[model samples]
Target: MSRTLPALRVTALAACLLTGAVLTHPALAATRAAAPSPAQQKLDRLADQFYVARAKFDPLLYATANGDSRYDDQIGMAISPVVRAKQFAQYHDQLRQLHMIARAQLPEKARLNYDILEFEINSQLDLEHFPEHLLPLNHFENVPSVLANYASGTGSQPLTTPAQYRAYLSRLNQLPAWIDQAIVNMKEGIRVGVVQPKAIVMKMLPQFQQLRSSTPEASIFYTPIKNLPAQFSAKDKEELTAAYRQAVERIGPALDSLCQFLESDYMAAARASSGYGDLPNGAAWYKARIKNNTNLALTPQQVHELGLKEVARIQRQLAELGPKLGYTGPANQLPQWVAAQDKFKPFHTEQEVLDAYRKIYATVDAKLPNYFSLLPKARLDIQLEPELTRATASDHYTPVAADGSHPGVFWAVVNDPAKYSNVGMTSLLLHEGVPGHHLHAALLKELPLPDFRKFYTEHPSAAAYTEGWALYCETLGREFGFYDDPAPYYGHLNDELLRAVRLVVDTGMHAMGWSREKAVAYAMQVLGYSEARATNQIERYMVWPGQALAYKVGALKILELRAKAQKALGPKFSYPKFHAVVMGDGTLPLPILEAQVDKWIASQK
Candidate 1:
């Protein structure tokens, strides 16, 4: 996800107030009558320390994305043993300090912040037992792939200023060393029997090859130099361009080296098995992933069983809806029938595809106020995915800049517009644009929460709540009047079925010993995905085990909470208030969110 925040300038006195430090300044002492409790002060100090330390020691992008520019000139070694040790030490120390705080003494808002910070700290500490750094690069998310986007001048990394350009060049100069470290970590993974599946390794090879260009000018890393602002002087442009070209030239060999290593040494060591269960301590690792992604104590078998029931439930609906759309096919064949329909593939150009999404946005915007009192200040913009990453990337949402400098972007992957089905367009817009990710994410940033909470959605701990809320938003299409047509309604069901299918197939492969081919075949049968598409989705699950499960698991919890609220409040129930409560405090863990919802329900009574 792309992350950028508005600049928050904190003066020394303001910083003291933020961290709950004692105010002895006469100007402030005269105005203040009561001081915060000691426990509250301790909690605030610990939270502030952890937040700043994370920005410094964690990935540089985490800081840069949040408008913290302290690490802009350095690409820190996130996967190195030394860095990992330091990160673990920091988390342990912070946890110790947090334990000393008296949670009962804090007010409701401070307690909420404490709970979130505690969850974040514990989540980091959980990784200390695992060797995640050893298996770092994946087809879905890797350093080189992300850095290429930063260099392309279109991603979260800013290239508007000369200093930004210089910082990027510094990062490019560091590329070789980072690639060398990844190789070292992968070698360790091989020794420890924690290698990626061969299928995933094969996917990474092509990505590295894509990053290598014949010359600096043709490289993605040269993009910023080419697009240098007109305000830059001739001398500034010349020096920066020369520096960028040299940096890009240096990066080519590094990419080629890594690509060659993966092709040869790494490929030979790659595991034939697809699931995490096949690795050393694989089952336990998969369990950790499930807990991290879903924030639930559900076992793999339970999740798998739940998925089976959900799939059956959604399939029954599809079977019933098929006849209305003039399809008399069996339930399993519904997706294929829908795919074959000419009416679904209406767009012939990218602009036509974009316009369709915009039209849906307009339709949803008019009806939003009826159901949502809490709306994002940031406007949503729809754009086609960039060519460099479009092939591997799905349509997704990028967060809005906190300062509203840039609108939230819904990137539609329209590689071949003629082949892009219009069936799911309305549901997709709702999920990724208006009331889905864009609304949830932008509103979180705008909340009067700690900086850590404002930026918390990027972490794995918040995945369930954020993704669940987005999936739930798709169901809102019915209330918004976008699903009156049978086609659009089918789209909603199709999307829901895909999430349900993920729960089953993800657990089946990682926990039940299902092969990659078996999982792909299951998706193709149920979701009517092409062989290539099914393989892509399955491989994604293989690389990021249990992540796909978040959508279904999270959505079901929200839906259940809403049902409880409706039953209890009856006539007093309000969609606007319920939505506001769900979204008002930014992203939260599932249990905390449920507790918040229950509290709101009681308040109405």
Candidate 2:
């Protein structure tokens, strides 16, 4: 089998054809056939070059993640200047041309290629425009913080060999510069009005200071060194032990410095202001970010309004379930019932957490045939988020490749499995696993589109279509005879409520001038999230503002579109055909998706 696009970043390459003057000459057309245009020939050659490029490329994302020699010499560091510049220019150049082709009536393959290319281009451009660097190190994904966990040698990177251990040492040593640059960039954001809210920065102090711990053994990053590889020569192990200590000395001090600066300087300097739009050039920056992310011309107010409608609709459902779950007496009692449910209580152990996720997958799968025309070829598994990452992460999906070599993963943060509630598992499973990302992405990767088209771009249609569809799935519990248990069905709506709350809270943070505290408070009280989980989600929105908006906004639009398609086609609509069309040619812009569906509907007649 051919290699798949490695990490699935949006990407594209274009082939343009030109017209010859002779082709435009009436006399030539009347008397003789036209000769080939050089531009047309060059464009064809460019297309061929693109194909060759695709064949040769398997993006080294895999090697980077594993710390393979493919980049063993390269330091596995983040926040570098050179890396960001090339990323910006390469994507900028590709998109400028790709957009040119998109405006043309090109062949279906060419349009698909350009569409995918546009997505890749946008992903790169998103960084430069957003003040992401301002709050570069969230408690969750900041590289310096994560390295301490990776240094523990329990993460994805291989630390088995003595040389591999040293390579990690080298990566650890590079942290001071990375953090220095990150601080510098963030300051730039400050001057320009790009800044993270002080609320998140306050939460960050404990995380970084935790790494500044007095003993290397006490540091989270020092765990790997605490245990040496048994196979290493004693002398080599001794040297590695020294090296690991030295690296941590370097990293530990940096973390401590970060802690000191964060406690004394950074948080003070951070804006009490919440939105990026509060910064200089803020509105334009926010607009560009929204457009790039949602792939539509949408205002914050528009999205804010969208969030409200979804919240109300979901609240109505929650009211209906409150009685079944012992929220008897009144509709208002539902929130009280939701808050008090023992079933909504988190797992007390990791096994319980995994078992809960497993139950969700099994229960859903048992009823899968009623909803899906496609399913992933690979199995799904649940695991604890790596200790290195769990502190910073919630839940996430890692999709399998086209070859079905990797199983789709539903990684829950099992460190605090007691914080893992069963109430949200069903809807969360739908979003991350079957009929959500895995099914949509795996099938798209397997489709007959061009290499770039298949893997690069995630069409607005897919996320809005698939996620919204899954959110809709949570509502379909009774239809499948699953949510009749009341608990699981409540779990399904709890998941749906989370997405709906994302709508309100995301908009509240970025658009309505809601403080981070206000966002979390609303989430805790109204959305029924625990203080710890609410803190994680709220901080995530602060670090990356508009992204949270996409989930509910996209999902709601898809549900609306599906209703439209169902109405237009009536009995003629085939669920299988509807799905095939949605998944067939890779991701699509929502407008194009609607058009594609409209065309498909016409074709049926």
Candidate 3:
């Protein structure tokens, strides 16, 4: 939060672009001034080169997901000291080059691009101060689990062509090296007293154990072999099959070795304290994370206070809804009664759950055009999360591939239908399906934006913009008439309350020294979450500090901006146009989005 782009750069770039040269004849100049300024031309060239550099710097996993095949053969490990130092140097060099540009001399859009690039480079630099690489893999972000998904042929990494097939094998061959580097980094973290919480480690070891297979066919690495194209030559198929067996043989032992290290050695060293603040200079680190995730200059206490108010307000609303739902008791106990009701937990089979989500998608898909003028062209499909990971997985959306070879996927983790409440199903579909991530992410690909903007996954400040937009989309159900039903309305409120609870508990765990148990207790007591659900939620916040805060903070900002626009424009305010403004620039920091909204409001006048 302390470091920011210089104001001089902003002013200088705009001035140089707008007033650098004066035409002798104003009339002739007006018609002939269609060409961009010299600063814009330079900025355009820099943007092109930046994307090239970004491609080389991207993690191999993200590169594969982005459909950039250039890095398929390279399992780029940034965990090692040598690699991390190089990454730091490269980021610094990019930052230096960005500083050279007269940001103020550029056009509006170009200047915004410059600011985004600067934020990304600076954020990467900021990350180097912490030992994040040491505690790299968690239950939430286990690389092996990700690799298994990809290898199992259900993920984004395409294995259609022979070249793509070989690329997959090459990546599998490099898994051992990635595992080795992670072990080294974990040891370094232990040496320096930075590690994941023991709770996460306990959960993670079982995942690795599940990945270990005795036979090649039984192994996840053998997934591609099962789906080999019939068009391949017999000799090529034989060679690939042998190679895959070898890779599986190698990967199996590596998985066991890594699991052993984590269970026996690293587990002992894992941090008992959940907060990042417990580490060296952790307070400042967590504050930077808050800024990074929220893209706002808010202190933890300020966020905490805001969260408390929101919780109280939502609880009041829940109380108001209770009598309407035939429950006249206290609001806090409403969720318990709702959970116990046979009507809310109506799904008796997994198929019923799938059918319910599909119906929700159909319902929302038909209503989207009423609220949004700009809709995604890409298709979205609903699928059940794989049984292997569904127990831990939440309902999530995977963006469509940049090439459109794959559609956006909305995966519902229907671990047990009898236990899964259908109350939040409508809100979940809206957030994860038609008008939430599927719409926002797929539309970004169709935008006339830079390739870097369209494809990258680990962009510096995207969570709040994207996730907040999804959360905001949840509120749209009311406008579309989905919340007229009491159950769905209660679900919407529960979802909103969940985000509010995140802000309180996320900051509480990281900044205010709340214990894991306290955070879990607060979640269960206030949100009516089950013990296991509360534990998982708290542990997620523990591992990834400040990320949960993005949802509430981002949604609030969007809501606030929409209110301001409606107030300013009054009769001229258009909901569709306002939505277009928010999403027009693709994913942006909330501050940039607010500015865009303000500009749209002025145009309406």
Candidate 4:
């Protein structure tokens, strides 16, 4: 998953440059010079209103994540039924307000904005039908894990000043209520047969147990106090430390209580079945997820078939490459053979693993200008995934701070350096770092887009565009000369194949009623993943249904658009220009993206 942050500083020169680019950019600059119509003005007002209103429900997410400090002392009760109901009602109201606007009369940019806002409002309304709040605690994403990241002083939550520290302490004070609410929701889920899978509940137990330290000093929440700025007065430092300790003490029991409930009552009620199809209204729910994530009206059966075809297509490429690497075996067995290679496991230390990624970064960074005309102003940094979440987290990109306090982070999960395979390092960095997420996301922020468009919290509905673009970036390895070697190229294919496999397995589990074991076995067989890797990936899909499908679904659409542009423009085609057309609008749904590309193609002709 990726996050977006506000721009650090818009220098006069930078602003002028942005203005010039927008005016000249083929995809963005409207041909008409007409002033805003009544509908356009109304649309802009509604967009601003929607952005501000949406922030109220999750001020911590909207403010802290975007570098706004106004809500620093607050963590809104998103899990509360009353709060959710209000938000749900707001979604309906927003949709109605959007409908009141005459979209056709609006300018092109305003119309696009209106369409996107409409899409978002409707997506939220569709999701509102499902009781997702009831089953909020999962192994992959839950409140405890999010709070731990903030308390660690390394995440979005800033802990620099006394006020920031107190703000976090205030948030800590509210932890018990949130946990209590989660329990209430989970119990209701149990009553309604919307409980999580037993395996996921078992996985979550350890995460909660990790939060129960004997003393506040030993807890992850104590990190801010330990790292307090030297500029702080002795009194301030001492006072802050005491407060954090007390806050931790209060928080520990809430965690313990939640864990105990999970172990005792929730565990007994957790469903043995894996798929959402097993739950009430689960089939329709899964279909909605498919539409949300893919942004294409694809059926589960359609996505599954697409995955099968992609698997075969990529496997043929892999089989051809395997022979070049002296592995003349079946395509399915190539991954196992590659994994066993000693050369691929050369790193013996964590630093060695990180250094390898950095080396790939340097190599890719130099070639970026050749393929992209629009690059992010924010720098990208590579780091190891934090210890608490490393076990379950995959390599991911964290956005840069809005105030430029933090650079974009590509967290490489190095559980064991010796076991870390170097085969996928280049492709992974491309996807999570430059020319992928960091490049796509940071550039989007720098664009003159609305806050709603640029900084809305990443949702599954937008995954098709975001994840799709990142996945497509992985293929740029060939163009960058990073895949000159057969090893990295094979790794790229494997990664692509992984996404293709996700489409099959995710839909199979959620929509087709495949067992968890069945899905895991299928991934292991097709991807040559170890039992653990396969199980972990399958479990992630189980928790986040339809999310895994976005990568392939989005990537394929972009690829299709690119192919269409290339065919239509012929000799007029440019990689950088094509990329600008795809990314120039920030993140967009597939249909909108295609429309934008078609407009660009015609403009060129």
lDDT on C-alpha atoms for all candidate structures = 0.82, 0.59, 0.78, 0.82
User: How many clashing pairs does model 4 include?
Assistant: 0
Q: For model 2, what is the alpha-carbon lDDT of residue 429? A: 75
Better of 1 and 3 by lDDT: 1
Q: For model 1, how does the per-residue alpha-carbon lDDT over 383-459 read when each residue is reduced to its tens digit?
A: 88878778788788877666544467788988898899988998899888888998887776665667777766656
**Residue 440 lDDT, candidate 1, scale 0-100:** 82
TM-score of each: 0.92, 0.78, 0.91, 0.94
> In candidate 2, what are the lDDT values of residues 1-605, reduced to their tens digit?
11111111111110011011001112322443235344333333444444333222212232332112334324432344555555556556655555444335554444444554555446446557554556567665566655564564434345677776776777677777767777677667667666667877877777776667678667665676777777789899788778767777777666656677777767777888766657776676666666655656788888777767877886788788777777676664465566665667766888887887787678777665545444444566666677655766877765444433344566776665554556667767776766666666655545444444444333322344445544555555655676777777877766777777776777677667788788888887767667877888888876665666666666666666667777887776655556555655556656656666676766667
The candidate, 2 or 4, that scores higher on lDDT is 4
Who wins the TM-score comparison? Answer: 4
| Total clashing pairs for each candidate | 0, 7, 9, 0
Find the 10 residues in a row with the least total lDDT in model 2: 14-23
Over 4 Å off, model 2: 1-86, 99-106, 122-131, 146-173, 190-192, 213-219, 222-249, 343-348, 387-392, 401-406, 414-420, 444-479, 530-532
lDDT of 4 by residue, 1-605 (tens): 01112222332233323321222334233333467788888888888877777666776656566544566677778889999999988888888988999888876778789989998788778788888889878999876687788876666676777877888888888888899999999999999999999999999999999988988899887888889999999999999988889888988889999989999999999999999999999999899889988888889999999999999999999988998888977767999999888888998899998888888888887777677666677778888889999999888877666566566788899999988998898889989998888887676667667877776436567789989999999998988887889999999999999999998999999988899999999998889899999998999999999999999999989999988988898888888777767876778888888888888888889
TM-score of candidate 1 versus the correct structure, residues matched by position: 0.92
> Sorted on TM-score, highest at the top, how do the candidates line up?
4, 1, 3, 2
Clashing pairs in 2: 10-120, 10-456, 12-117, 148-221, 152-224, 423-491, 468-555
Compute the lDDT for candidate 4: 0.82
Candidate 3, residue 352: CA error in Å?
2.3
